[model samples]
Target: MALMITDECINCDVCEPECPNGAISQGDEIYQIDPGKCTECVGHFDEPQCQQVCPVDCIPHDPGHQETREQLMEKFIRLTASK
Candidate 1:
């Protein structure tokens, strides 16, 4: 599953740079995680980097966007294919 930022997010700008997939971004109010680009750090790290770095622990598993490891890897590949 991908991780999502909840409204509890303090917008402290702590999670953005920690995302290996570049999935986290600054939103109008809170930081947002792009599900399409999020891979849960499957190919880059042992765990979701954003979640690990989140100061408020606002990042949570996105049950609405469940995916297998293979699927996550595929998404990661596609996201980085252009570069």
Candidate 2:
């Protein structure tokens, strides 16, 4: 599943740079994770980098954007190929 930044995000500005996929960005209120661009760090790291550095613990698996490991890997591949 893609990770989501909840409303609880404190805008610490830490998580945004931690996202390897560049999925997190500043929204009107808080940091937002683009589901289409998110891979939960599948091709980049063993764990989501954003989640590790977020002080608020607001980053969580997006159940609404669920995907299996294989699916996430495919998404990661697509993202990298475009770069």
Candidate 3:
């Protein structure tokens, strides 16, 4: 599943740099995670890098954007291929 930044985010600026896919960005309020670009680090790491680095622990799996491991891997491949 793609990960999302919760309201509890402190805008610490740590998670943005941790996202390998560049999915995290500054939003009007806190930070935002683009589900389309988020693979939860499936192809890059065992755990979501952003979640690992976030100081506030605001990142969590997005139930609305759920996907299996295979699907996340497919997304990773697709993203990498385009770049």
Candidate 4:
């Protein structure tokens, strides 16, 4: 599943650089995650890098963009192939 940054985000700027998919970006107030680009670090790491670095633990699964583990891996492959 994809992850999202909650309103609890302090904008500390740590999570943005940790996203392997470049899905995190500075929003109008807090950071935002692009569900289409997020793969929960499936092919890159065992855990989500952004979640690992977020100080406030504000990152959580995006229910609206839910996908299975295999789907996430497919997304990872597609993203890297395009690069």
Q: By summed lDDT, which 10 consecutive residues of candidate 3 come out lowest?
A: 51-60
User: For model 3, how big is the CA root-mean-square deviation?
Assistant: 0.6
lDDT of 2 by residue, 1-83 (tens): 98898889889999888888889999999999999999999989999999899888999999899999999999999999988
Error of 1 at 27 (Å): 1.2
Weakest 10 consecutive residues, lDDT, candidate 2?
Answer: 15-24
Off by over 4 Å in 2: none
Q: Specify the poorest-scoring 10-residue window by lDDT in model 4.
A: 47-56
Cα misplacement distance, residue 20 of candidate 4 (Å): 1.0
Per-residue alpha-carbon lDDT of candidate 4 for residues 1-83, written as tens digits (9 for 90 to 100) = 89999999999999988888999999999999999899999999999999898888999999899899999999999999988
Highest lDDT model number: 4
Candidate 1 structure quality by residue, lDDT tens digits, 1-83? 88889999998988898888888999889999999989999989889888888888899989989999999999989988898
Q: Predicted candidate 1: what Cα RMSD to the true structure?
A: 0.9
Following a full C-alpha superposition, what root-mean-square deviation does model 4 have from the true structure? 0.6
**For model 4, how many clashes?**
0
How much lDDT does candidate 4 score?
Answer: 0.94
**Which of the predicted structures, 1 or 4, would earn the higher lDDT when compared with the native?**
4
TM-scores, all models, native as reference: 0.93, 0.97, 0.97, 0.97
